[model samples]
Target: MATKTADADLKTASVLAFERKLDPSDALFSAGRWDERDDPARWAPVPVREKSVRGTISNRLKAKDQDPAKLDAQIDKPNLQTVDVAALPADADTLKVAFTLRVLQGAGSPSACNNAAYQAKLRQTVEGYVKAHGFIELARRYAHNLANGRWLWRNRTGAEEVEVRVQHLVQGAPATTWRFDALKLSLRHFDAPGEMTETLDEVAQLIARGLSGESHVLLGVSAFVRVGAGQEVFPSQELILDRDSTKKSKTLYTVADVAGMHSQKLGNALRTIDTWHPEAATLGPIAVEPYGSVTTLGKACRQPKEKQDFYNLLDGWLLKDRVPAPEQQHFVMATLIRGGVFGDGE
Candidate 1:
């Protein structure tokens, strides 16, 4: 069977100006599955194309019912120019891809999304501080994830070689774009190869100061993607990410989802430098917020403890517990005496 040519498989999309980041606020992680995709097969076959990729302007602050991240449900069509890989010069020696991280608007601004109450004064205050401080850190982490090919889940494993250049906007103009091939040095067999790590910290620290309204900073990412036979290029793909995955284990991040692990997983990889997450700056360790332990979401809700020490120990003991609990003692003994484990009360 003829396979899709490497060039035909290369897909790309540039999210129009919006503060984008996949920090903890994204709620992308879970206890059973990993990445933004809850599907068992993380990567799916998407026809590569370029068009005006429009979406709703919202965040996951209210993941559940109140502040659902549904764009069409809340606001009208938000303009997003999505440039497909095919639109770019394909015949060139190497496919040079360029992405811009422009500071579109702040979470405090009323033009951010639909509801003003959602971006109310309190949310604005908290959102501003987060944008100014940890956005760079979050951006660095995102760059690291991208540089290392962490988002290449299944279809596009790793590229033979990749080059990346990062630049920050200054004085209403961008500085010279600096190319870095260091991400190719990323090491971790059985995992995504050619990860850009050693260079990420350096890139993260490049912009030391936090953001301010007056600051018009833009992070530009330009790289070359190869689409040769037996070669793979993992470009960004826009997909539907559902936050509610109660029916399956693949939804939660593989029962071992943690901060670093999820941070590295794919699915809508890194998009923009800033995000609408309320507290994207100071976030705590990986945890189950609405469920896994039961709270306001519902008293019966109990999400698995993927990282908590107590549950980790219990799971370990359960695996080694050859003997069943008292409730199962009668069943065990009856199985030996009778043909099957019938009744314990008898």
Candidate 2:
């Protein structure tokens, strides 16, 4: 009996899937005084309420409806629609958002896979990459996002001061805590500033350990934003499909009437660490995605034509035995850590 050649065994798995390593719960919103942040028990949940507002005809009229008289008549009738809104109380000067993140182990293992040969080969490949480079870079970037309050989204914009508290949870209690002056960190880059580098390293090490199957990591994150009294805050918008115009025009996400941000939204912010793509020099870091897609921009930074997308790099590395550059390898591994189904149709 002759041994099978390596080339013959190299093939793309038809059913391969990876589980996401970084999992976060929905962020709940609350209101309190900036000074009262130490006493979170007294904080009140931010409630989502409905309000009716007259819509202005700010949208450009079509050529057919551009007539001055018709436009005046249309403007005269108030476009009344009900929308949901959340705001801080007049007495409250701060908004507090809290969430839990669970970091699981087994970064390269596939949750679902059919081909044993391909799975074994892929595992070996990932192991090789791990031996060459650890997950510190990726982990550090994630830590930066958490510390900088990137998950606060619009709420962080006009905040007079923003503070983030990250606690290492053990047995449902904080074992260690790290505080960050969020506005001091820039979101455009992941460079660790001098003052916060040491603390960030500790957080990154925990996350990397979790990813490398060394330990399970649980983080409790709380962000406090001082946006002034009675200011409105933005929550995740509910995507309502197939609804009539008479229904509420806008819907804010809520958990038991308390305004909340979606877990998916928080996850997206955490994984916004893809800065190795071709256009990254000009576009800055984007969310870690297979295609380097930025939905808001309606463009993919890593185009297949450039052979930089996840699929292309993965196939070349596994099937063609063409190893990517160091930076590109990091991107590929980050995508795997991000997790997705990547199976060849053929």
Candidate 3:
């Protein structure tokens, strides 16, 4: 058929890439009194300390190693190891996590695209989607993630109190500020309860404007976690490969000797909004990856065979001129916003 010939001629771009729009700086950790939260400047930086501990033989042993004599020998061998840790000083009851985020514009515009026609069609499709649905849903989910302090990660567990403050920065000062009782917001869903809806809407609108190229949006986020004096706080761990056996077994992240989390980790938490993938009903929302990959779960929800992965959906839309369903449109757009190298192979 003529249609088949045309399709065959219209190959995917050999070089297509997009830069990430939601940018976040490294999150630095500080410690202070719950009452002294008003003066974050006075807070002391939480420092990573090296600790030595004998490892416990608690891991499940292989069937062959389950022999009582072998197990006893393993337990007798001291697994001495040194690791890095971060904890609040005895005088401090709250951990202050601070970071900055910049929301850049241009969601679907590829930074590199060899195929001009495909690029044009892609832009047109993105513009159409923008006109029809806008970025409200995506923006709202991002705002929810901020309000809930999802970026706090392991430090959020069993906290006596958690407060998140988001400030819209303009000209180096706060133009608008929103304070959230982070514990009250559920992490499982994007919905904001009635009382927080108005505030959440304001934040979402600002994010939407940023994504739509209406304005530059910069946010300063500070989370105060009341984990009690001397309680341990969690910072991102460093992944050391091909390590020397004598080196520290665990290494935590730090910025200038201050405990910190990676910007990539924070960005991952912010974009955890892909609930439209096929397995979402049972698996819940996941970070918006092209393959709907949940690294922690070791599963890819958007399988190619299901024709739900980004390439399949995107090729169908741009090459075949088949507009996907509303939810799928959102997924595709969200993936564009997430941004990455997505070129087709020659």
Candidate 4:
């Protein structure tokens, strides 16, 4: 009836613990979403160490090396070699903290990436820019003056003649000048020979058609023989326009014959059309061989009437009413239209 009088007794169960080896790959601990899991919250937050005494010692050593003069001012009665890592915060990780110290010590001004090849390329590009822009400016000036009918002169001898002059201001007292009369364009006092030569040649061709009178006009470079000391003369290369020899006796052509020669020469130089093609006209009158023989298709075609017709056709093609082929039409239209548009824009 007393329920066997409860005795103070306690029973304890035995606990068993087992250790398992993890696979080499599975043993990895990631700080963030290092797997395919997109949820960043699933990853354990990385522990941020508050301070490191080892890092401070390393920083002091680095500072001493970097600025020895400033180190004495910063720490009086300093024992930089005896700085202890145990003095730092409890959560400090020396290895990671050392990395920060190294980073700070290594920081300085960025180094230049200079090399000979790169410098040469840069110089070439700058030179190209100057040359190109200079040519463009020259062309623009010429076109503007032409449009304004400024300084346009006619050939007194009747042979087509147009002259262009470009003067470069030289820097010197008692200034001396070098003159180049190529293609009837005079370049004076140009320091850069190559640029001056190229520019003068181009300008000369531009005005070649308008200049008529002589058998050959100056082109490229020419040497002017000075008659006396301190007297400079310019000798320029001449571009000649002569008729085929076979037609010399048949036609009564004069200095006026070179009217459309410039355009022909340009077309030939450009190689847009075959030389044999009648449409492939020269800027000047056709060249006549010494004995008045005309060369056509490697055959000597002799006739005054044919020569006259050839020149007439050329003139028509250049200035008069002649429909250009589709290719030529497009080329001509594009050039003329662009020129007109640019003129308008200016």
lDDT, candidate 2, 1-346, per-residue tens: 1324774567888899998999999999999999999996879999999999988888977998999999999899898899999999999999999999998888888999898888887898999998999888889999999999999999999899999999999999999999999999988998867999999999999999988889879999999999999999999999988687438999999999899999999999999888898888888889999999999999999999999999999999987789999989999988998889898756
* Candidate 3 pairs with clashing backbones: none
Q: What's the distance in Å from true for residue 199, model 3?
A: 0.4
List candidate 2 stretches off by more than 4 Å: 1-4
1-346: candidate 4 lDDT, tens digit per residue = 2312211121111221111100001011112211312343543312211222221222436634567666655455443221111111223111000000000010011122233333333234324433433223323323223221122111111212222222222232212222432223321111234545555454434333212111122222111111222211111112335644332212211122211112222222111111222333432222222112234445432233553232233223333435344333323221221121111011
Candidate with better lDDT, 3 vs 4: 3
- Cα lDDT listed for each candidate: 0.34, 0.91, 0.92, 0.24
| Weakest 10 consecutive residues of candidate 1 by summed lDDT | 335-344
Q: What's every prediction's RMSD, in angstroms?
A: 24.9, 1.6, 1.9, 45.5
Worst ten in a row by lDDT for model 2: 1-10
Q: Please, what is the TM-score per model?
A: 0.35, 0.97, 0.96, 0.16
Q: Quick one: best TM-score, which candidate?
A: 2
**Per-residue alpha-carbon lDDT of model 3 for 109-173, expressed as tens digits?**
99999998778778888989999999998899999999999999999999999999999999999
Candidate 3 lDDT score relative to the true structure = 0.92
- Per residue, candidate 1 scores C-alpha lDDT tens digits across 159-267 of 4445555666576566645555534533232122334344565555553232323444466554443333322223333232663533221222212222112332332
Span of 10 residues, lowest total lDDT, candidate 4: 95-104
Best by lDDT: 3
